[model samples]
Target: MKFLQIAAIAAALSALTFGCQKKAEKKASYPPTPATLVKAEGKSVRKYIDTLGTISSLHSVNIVPQVSGQIVKINFEQGQFVKEGDVLAEIDPRPYAAAVMQAEGNLRQAEAQLKIDALDVERNRKLAKDNYVDKQTFDSLLAKVEVDKGVVETCKAALETARINLDWCKIKSPISGKVGLYNINSGNVVAAGTSVITTIEQLDRLYVDFVVPSQRLYDVKRFMEANGGKAAVDVSYIEDDLGHRKTVAEVDIILNKIRYESGTAVLRGRLDNKDGLFWPNQPVKVRVNLEEIKGAVLIPNMCIQIGPKEPFVYIAAPYKDGVYVISQRDVGEGQLFDGGMRAVSGVKDGEMVVKSVSSLRLQAGPFVYAATPEGLIMGADSKPILDPAKMREFMSNATAIADELRAKFAKEAAEAAAKKQAPVEALKAAEKAAAGE
Candidate 1:
């Protein structure tokens, strides 16, 4: 009896000792690595698709001499702007003038022969009626009259040709345009249709051609139709300024046909070159902004993490007085901001998101480190664009979270081990059953 009583007392003491032993002290809390903090900042975002293209003249033609001769005079100054009908070069017109006079003389001779034939035909007709001459002779005279008229017409055509050739000796501007340097200087003999004097390109109203991906055809067409007119599209043309793009002009026009192989299409806009701000054959960049989108929520680009296939972003929830939990979600993004993505869905326009990217650790909140403010990227006085080591520090803090989890559960782990159950299985079964219960 005394032995049983002593054993009972010992058991009570053992239970008391075990219960009184201090549980594993809670691990110290570290500031959470941010998943980049983002505020609900609303701003105007223009949706643009950009591509490179070359400038072309709306109307351009080459100046070539139509008549060949020794260039007696360079009528226009080299590289001068000339109006339509402006005489540019003077060729030696002596030979062509002589040809014109010869043609005129030949035409007069043909007309003289025609008059004689007509008189003979008329006299023979009168005499034949009175049997004053042979019937065959009168018939022959009538035939000669018809033949002479044809000859006269042929000579007239020759005269017209000679006159035209004479006029062509003075090379004239076909269109009002700026003429390029002379191909044939004065004193150089040139052949008709074989010499290129220069080029004349009309610069007043120019075709500003820009190419876009063929894949955009449907989107462009659909948007154009939805907008109810071609004018609904605004094309902003830009060029590099100090290594950055600045739009110099904006206009509206129709988009040309789609290219099948490359799946791209061209757009043209009218621009005035009176100020000589643009040049032909120069490269250009274009952005077609289809008016304002009715409702689109833009999220920060740092929030959108790009994976191999699909893109994703993390959302943080603050629950139960500082416990923050993070959940990952896929999002559709459009035109990128300087540092943010224009989120189409999976996030509301005014919702907060991770932007600075240091708080990815401690998904279950309470460890949020208030975000440090960031300003726009400044120039030469700018800070380094990137800091990897700083990011790594956050990543290390996030990783260190695993140790606290290990320490907090030391007693539970020992009890679970004594019960002879696998820790992984217990975790899964416990989580699954706990969720169900």
Candidate 2:
């Protein structure tokens, strides 16, 4: 009777296991689908190509010491914002003052000599005219007067030069701008030749030197030509942290040719920075609108999915039962329009493309159950409704996978380097052997 009980128990356990397996298989065969189907409307989307740029000043100037002397005093503080006629630094004027005094004394002596020469010339001419003196004597006196006049002129020139040098010791500003760090301190000996004491970058007008990849330049020129070639290049400055972008006055220029070294053409834009915002060499983002992809189909940036090979979208098409079914197609993307991807090909106006393709890539299996906009559940909802949070997680996973692959490559590279080093070691040993070690 105990053996019979055991056999019955074993049979019951086997039946229960079989039932659980069947249920699991059924559940695996059909997964839960989304409730609402977001159909892809056929339309154009803009592809915004993002790049890094730097901000610059329109009138940046450097402060160099032209005349040599000890930097007696710092006329302005470091990082001080100054204007066109502001004084920046001062040089010791004592030496220049002495030179001016010397020049002035020389000029006075020259003037005295000129007066004596003039009196002699006049007296000699009168004597010759009265027939009491010879023409040779009068001519010699006239020559003396001419030489004295030349001496006076030379002394005057020297005096003017001395005064100019004396004035230069004041070390006023060449331009209105913000001063850079002080390279030379007070009592530092500055010379005539070379050494930048400081720099003054004029922030009122600024130029941005940026590179265009040459792909979008055509669009830019065309857009500008439609409005007016030179007039159309609009300059805008955006402050950090989502600050409002403002348009500065009349400061835009495009470089004619691409730089052969970088394969990118340099473009420049000018900004009127009255608020002293942009400084020289400060980097910022600059967007230059070239031209419009006129009448091109536009769609929400979220609608399209960016893959390794190309961008694609999911659209709704009419199937057998007057219901919209999801269809996937590749799109030809153009320049970015309004921070969105521009759809150049593969779509038409008024067609719906599904937005947020990340979730759809995972949620929909080989076939998704789709619920139509008409509120009819045909089969299961095959069209994907985006759960932004879940989609973000999937995207993060993809990025993590990419990072892992990169790490693997890096590891392999390190291992390969170790292997290569071993051969070099052997080569060194062989060389030591040849050297009779």
Candidate 3:
């Protein structure tokens, strides 16, 4: 009885296994999946190199006192826009003024002595000519006149020096720009040429400084030469969270010297910041356009699939019952393009490519159909109609695929027609014999 029970259990397990196998086989015979199809198209594209860079003021100046003095007045507030030669601060001018006066007094004394010496030389010359004075005395008087002229010139130089010192008392801006914070306040003593009073930077036009490998400098220069001594550059500020960049300006790029330590060359971009969108020393994204690809074949990056050795895409050909024959063609892929498109070499213009709903389910030569929204209709409820424009585009893609398939099989179609006609002619001859024709 125990042996009979074991035999019954084994029979029941065998029946269950057989039932599961039949169900799985039924599920595997379903129809092919549908996919979104798009066409490869030609577009104008540009090649660019992306790098990080720093924004800076094109022109910056450090304001310092040319002469040491106590600051008596401050003329500019921090962060004020100033013009060239605008007075910024005032130093005490009393000492310089006194020096000017003393030099002028010395100049007058020298002039007076020069006049007396000249008169004495003229009188001695006249006496020597009449033999009343010796030639040596006349020569001595002429030498005295020359010495007086030298004293006058020395006094004049002293006066000019004093005047320059007095001018320095009023510190002025050397360039037109916005001023930074003041380092010293009024009544503070500053050292000549060493103390930092403030800083001014020109912001109407800005510079973006970036570095790239030295090998790329040649490409930069070649691009510039082709595009009128300037390569196109874009400056952008990046948002860290979303990884998006906001372009601040489009500018021209200038190539600079290479640094041997890092084997990188510095590049400077001149950006017009008349709107003050960018700030100095701010980090930004820099993109330099190296070259342009004309008539480039472009397709969405999603359409490209990796094959055993190269990248490939699925070319869709129209098949029976609104389905497509997906054939894989190897492609040479280039740089990433705008709008998530990639440049490819193997595909021609206007070829339909499949967009997979689930990339993992996609494989070479898998059957597919065009996706539509007809299933949205329900009983006793209104459904959203297909967009007219989108429907037209879908129909157009189907027509294109059909046309391509027809052209590809044109020779075979002629051969099939000949075969069909030959059989029909044979039947006609047999019918004529029966009719005694």
| lDDT of the candidates, in the order given | 0.63, 0.62, 0.75
- The best candidate by lDDT is 3
Best by TM-score: 3
Pairs with backbone N, CA or C atoms under 3 Å apart (clashes), candidate 3: none
TM-score of 1: 0.70
Name the lDDT value of residue 78 in candidate 1.
68
lDDT per residue as tens, model 3, 231-294:
7777778555634544444445554456889998887778888777788998887778889889
Between prediction 1 and prediction 2, the one with superior lDDT is 1
| C-alpha lDDT of residue 120 in model 3 | 91
**Candidate 2 residue lDDT tens string, 334-420:** 544554545546777766555532354332221223445553343423543366774455345434443333334335545655797
In terms of lDDT, the poorest run of 10 residues in model 2 is 26-35
For residues 204-261, write the lDDT of model 1, one tens digit per residue.
6566677667777666667667765442222233534522422334334545567788
Give the per-residue Cα lDDT of candidate 3 at 31.
Answer: 36
The per-residue C-alpha lDDT of model 1 at residue 407 equals 31
lDDT value for model 2: 0.62
